[model samples]
Target: MGGSTSASPCSSYQPSPSTVPFQRPPSRFKDINKNHVRLDLNSMVSTLVSDLGSVDINLKKQRSGLLKKHRDSQYRLVELQLVVRFPCFTMTGTPPSLFTMPPRRRANSVRCGKATQVSGETHRVTEKNGNDSLDICRVLNGMWQTSGGWDRIDRDDAVEAMLRYADAGLSTFDMADHYGPAEDLYGIFINRVRQERPPEYLEKVRGLTKWVPPPVKMTSSFVRDSVNVSRKRMDVASLDMLQFHWWDYANTGYLDALKHLTDLKEGKIKTVALTNFDTERLQIILENEIPVVSNQVQHSIVDMRSQQKMAELCQLTGVKLITYGTVMGGLLSEKFLDTNLNIPFAGPPLNTPSLQKYKRMVDAWGGWSLFQALLQTLKGIATKHGVSIATRCR
Candidate 1:
């Protein structure tokens, strides 16, 4: 909320809109092991428990009814997967669900290999024809992770990192109209790409952003203005993709917003995407025949809730799932590795209200004890594959 927007500071907080590649002197010193980049997770957890030892884990309060059912199914699927493979746990008194084996992270075994040049709307992700040809990097650039205080990002360094990622063939972008100046930053990068690269090369960069309006009455002018604001800030004449989000469904002004947005797309504003729309509501949108290409949602090992139903639904609707929170705010990585439940974490204070909200989620889904088991399980998997636990989530 601590943004330049005239609204609540945290509510509208914007970071430096996309900066062309950031320029920073490369550190000459030995690089810290990527696996252990943050402060000690174990110590932080201990301090945290000492401070809020009596605090209850906030799990069930914030999510929609649709999310719970979806998440339950995913958890059950995982349980079934584990039971089939590790009958030992099932034979023991403990059920597979209670076994608490952390999900493994094998960095070398990601399904997506290095992508090559884009030929058309679809690019060949692999040499094989039928592996997976998702052209828009299913995982777009995430600015939300930068919003929370889980890590300290050097702005200049971060910009340079973006350049590196783009060079590596991960060009599709994932951002929100409200994610500070992420859209603006993407715009700046695109302009630079247009100048430095050939026209064909420049087309590889596609940005997908969201428009999250308060649940309220929507008019054509209001919707157009919202898109215009993003266009002006991002300095783009046409948005490559526009995603939409709303806080309350009961209000139902979202329909009006979507109708107008689809009009923008028809007008060649770019593709339309959705962020965090539950499957039921998503179905409603599709039932009405609203066109959308992707739905951005929180999907990670701990939150495989998306897999419960979204994956199947996506297959049915031909929509792709662009996921975030797969890393659990870095809590899923080595930062929390070997961390005991008693310590509190120390990182930059969170600016996005969602961080605080999600911390409550960490409380639920099995508190520190359950989380500890998950982490231990992940550690085992990480060790098996020779990669950090973080890479597994990625």
Candidate 2:
């Protein structure tokens, strides 16, 4: 997905981690006369594991039903590889610490350890025409990793990771025009799927690509040409979703651009959407009768500016939200918890574009100290619920 940060007034302090011990209260202090409740951590963990297993089974059943329906309708067969992987576990349902240490690479594999076994659910969004819809994974595999500063991503490894995610049911991917080689990488991965997997599984994969164009005259040919380029790069005859982004709303040309994109829906595009548009411009687009299914925006626990107005307007207009920065470029995880956000780095600096972008958001949200407190509270909740801090943040 594309990257952007929100600046809004927010709290500067958050509750610290619940340090109150998990032990039962003393008999003298207990309210025996009234009803009492107690929680057992072990039992909660067991239930969580059971629920996850049930969800996995249900997802498989759903996939099977969908595939059958597609075949009955004579739609193109898109086969999905069903692979099972084991989940990581710890005795206490939490990691050893809240600090992310530097990664230690293995000689044979780019990934440090076994892949985690979590799958995203799928949802279908109907287009404005209501004649067709797109099924997308709730958790989109973002391709911003290809952007500079994270690390040198080997092309082969990146394609392998895409396959791994697809096998795990994360079939929807989000990429953009500016993200380096992201579209080309998707083309390679899809070609691999076509060559190796069953034809039925091909329809399960969806790529939601973006068009971040410079503010200029948005002629019919210009819009068609840009979208055709993305389609060629991704090796798709028709794009699943084409999200248009404009840097400066002052130009007043975005309307013409979106109109032209909407005109192309008859051919190369399936659904047209928006990215990083505020409520005001979104209103303008809607008033112009543009058929937008969703708006990609920066939304997380810390930054809630969207909820204040954008969400309400979307509710009224029936426009859904595709959120990014939910984990703040991994800063919301335990790795950054309790760290000195102000001091210079003892090791390598925060080099990735995502880290640099979200660090500024952390500072604007209330600096490092407040964020640490939030992380601590999140850790406590995650432990009680038998999930990782990263999962809780998401």
Candidate 3:
């Protein structure tokens, strides 16, 4: 799951909401310094994680059905959690300060790319396609960690983390059927939210789960059964979005699978999307009249493949792009910015699965020297803007 096989993009690097192009004002960068940027980065991450832990504790209690008798009382608890968490995540109406930047233009046009203001402070992406469209958070919490290549996660902790992310206005989540325990965790989180929060608040949360099945004979029974399994696991009557992926394009059954999914959209799914599909295949799917809203792909500064042909196809077909690998598995951050170039091979190995996977990408994208140069440029920009390199990348 860690290697690019997941074809996962980082949950960061969402499209900007502003219709007008953003040119960072020169005046804002005049007073920035490295110390200030470092402080802000450390403080921001620490505060987010710290506040999340407290909210997670409370959510764990609610998930355990401790507040069923006093549902009305639990509403205030939910509100408090949201109020505390929202400021940490959203960048609504903020000035061009060190920590805030306008949304970046994506390679492909994203539907509902604009952020809808809810309560003046919170922003959510509201797809403007009549009744079928959904309002979701731009930053979707990627759950591939549950799929593997990461540490073992306790079920309660994972569920609590989902609540933390949801309560923070990061309501949209990305998961797949193959990701072990991910759908189950969302099911638990959604059930807890439904039991504890009011309808309006619960509606703000969106789960964008995926259905990546093996290449097989696409029968109605087969497709329906697969969709039903996810529904049962997520404890939802209708899924917010189902992003389908196929391992082998040689098998033309993917079209049949999508047709069945489209049929089930009447009641089981709100939107149908694709994952890891190239331009030609995507065009073929659209030509067949399958209503795919978006295509998820591996997109980052390091990997600009999507911008070449996929962006044009997406622009023509009205399919928005949901990109991952935007942060290049954390390589675009400050930790590696000025490290020693010469080291014994195999002495300091790439530790995480993400690191190992993206290292290959770094090599292919002009090797270590050029990558280090890019990182240095990013560091300069971050220092100039008084923000972390990660913030700049996003």
- C-alpha RMSD by candidate, in order: 14.0, 21.1, 20.1
**Mind giving the per-residue lDDT tens digits that candidate 3 earns over 1-394?**
0111111222222221111112211211122211100000000010111111122122333223312223233211231121122221122111111011113332221222222322222344554222346566655678766655465667788788777766655677888776667788889889989988789878788888888676678899999988898898889999999988775667899999999999998999999887777677888888898888777766554554554456656655557667666676677778777664357552345666556667766655445665675666566556765666666212
| Alpha-carbon runs more than 4 Å astray in model 3 | 1-122, 127-132, 340-349
Q: Give residue 254's error in model 2 in angstroms.
A: 0.7
> What clash pairs does model 2 have?
77-200, 78-200, 78-201, 78-202, 78-203, 79-200, 79-201, 79-202, 80-201, 100-335
lDDT comparing candidate 3 with the true structure:
0.57
lDDT of 2 by residue, 19-59 (tens): 22222222121121221111111100001111111111122
Please give each candidate's TM-score.
0.64, 0.69, 0.68
Writing each residue's lDDT as its tens digit, candidate 1 over 208-242 gives 66776665678999889878877776677888778
Candidate no. 2 TM-score? 0.69
Instruction: Candidate 1: list runs displaced more than 4 Å.
Output: 1-134, 145-158, 344-358
- Candidate No. with top lDDT: 2
